[model samples]
Target: MKMVFRWYGTGNDTVTLKQIKQIPGVEGIVWALHDMPAGEEWPMDKILTYKEQADAYGLHLEVVESVNVHEDIKLGLPSRDAYIDNYKKTIEKLATVGVKTICYNFMPVFDWVRTELFKELEDGSTALFYEKAKVDSMDPGELVNRIANELDFTMPGWEPERLKLLAPLFEQYKQVSAEDLWRNLQYFLEQIIPTAERHGIQMAIHPDDPPWPIFGLPRIINSRESIRRLLQLVDSPCNGVTLCSGSLGANPDNDIVAMVHEFKGRIPFAHIRNVRVYDNGDFIETSHRTSDGTVDIAGIVRAYHETGFTGYARPDHGRHIWDEPCRPGYGLYDRALGIMYLWGVWDSMRAGEVAKRA
Candidate 1:
């Protein structure tokens, strides 16, 4: 696997490219133009700027975390066609800069949801926490304000401009159902997959953060079966899945190993992280070590090795350890540590295979 790191960009992130370069085995950065809003075509000049920065550090900008799907596209509004055309344009532009995979999600209101950004763990380090009861009881507006205002930087999904009028967005989604979402997603794929293929890029859909509906919003890409259906939507190699472990691991029923084996060639990018699930249906992010969380991170890496995966993979969200004042889940210390742990497991497995052949 080709390990990578996520960098928000200059000035917007606390972690610098210099620091990311120090991390062993990280060859690239998973990035996007955060200041650019969804549905609009990304500026080529701005895209070139980012490319120049990554080039300075000798880091390949091959994987983009998201070119976010617009609310209009998700709501299946009349304006969706225009937005989709813009998406196609963006895909073509990204291809010119050598981006191999684009990770986007179809979740309606939020990209990822968490009740607490810094819930103290038993070990004193804090991590992103999701409380099921709290999410169910809290008003969407209140929740949005709490998350949007608490962070120093703009959170990926909870863009201030998008959540400024929550009620209207929710109302727009009221007309959309799970089936409608699937149809709209299929339409989107049919439109963009050809563009992605023509440009030598794969469109990988990130599964819903919690793999479940929240605030009555429909989340379709949560389970193994749903992902299977998604692949069949376009029946093309350009159509793919991000295969996030922490997102689908929240459900506990998702067989991530099976997914790796089944979708071997299709998964062009992966977000490997661990989360400890509670009996009460809440979860907290943990280190990548197998014992630290419920997710079989070691097994998952072995699965990739067994399948001869050479795709781009990154250590996903990590705990806010060492008093690091970084993005909620995108901290430096723990993620770097997670990368070391992943390399340990992956390298050992490869060595064992060599021994067997000998």
Candidate 2:
């Protein structure tokens, strides 16, 4: 597996590219142009600026976190064709910078939902937390405000532009069922997947944050069966899954290791993280260590090794440690620690394989 780190650009992030380079095995940065809004084509100069910055640090700028899919496309509006064309142009430009995979989601309102950004645990180090009861009981508008209030930087999915249109977006989605969303997604894939194929880039669709519907939104990309169906939608090597352990792991039913084995060549990017899940349906992001969370980090790494996975892998969200003020889940310390843990797992597995072969 090729290890990569998620670096929010120059001024937007607390972690610097130099710090990222210090991590032993981090081969690249999973990056994006965060300032640009959805449906707008990214400028070529901006894309090359990121490439130059990563090159300065000897890091590859191959995996982009997201290129936001406009709600018009998800709504399958008459204007969706125009947005899809914009998406195609963005893909072609990213290809110019040698970006191999573009990680994005199709959630209607929020990209990911969490009730608390710094929910303190018994250990004193805080992490992103989800309280199921809070999400179910709270008004979404209030929830968005609460989340925005906690962040110094704008949260990606909860952008003010999208949030301002929430009421109308919900009204638009009122007529869209899960099936309609699937059809719209298929339409999107049909239009853009061919372009992605021609450019040699993989369109890695991130699974729904919690792998379930929230605030009455129909979330279709939530399970193993949904993944299977998604692959059938475009039926091309270019159309693929991002396979995030924490997101899909929110649902206990998802067999992440099995997905590693089953989706073998179809997965181009993997977001490896752990979460401590409770019986009441709430979860907290935990360190990448296997014992710290419910997800089996060791087993997942082993499966990847067995499948001969050489695609990009990243240590996903991490805890806020050392009292460092950083993005809620994108902190540097814990994520760097997570990378060490992942490297340990991967190295041990490699040693075991060598011993067996000998």
- What tens digits encode model 2's per-residue C-alpha lDDT throughout 129-215? 999999999888889888888888767898888889988888889999999999999999999999999999999999999888888
CA lDDT of 56 in candidate 1? Answer: 95
List ranges where model 1 is wrong by over 4 Å. Answer: none
Off-target runs (Cα >4 Å) in candidate 2 are: none
RMSD of each: 0.7, 0.8
TM-score of each: 0.99, 0.99
Model 1 agreement with the true structure over 112-171: per-residue lDDT tens digits: 999999999999999999999999999998888788778888678988888886899898
Query: lDDT scores for all predictions?
Result: 0.93, 0.93
Provide backbone clash counts, one per model.
0, 0
Clashing pairs in 2: none
Error of 2 at 271 (Å): 0.3
> What is model 2's C-alpha RMSD?
0.8
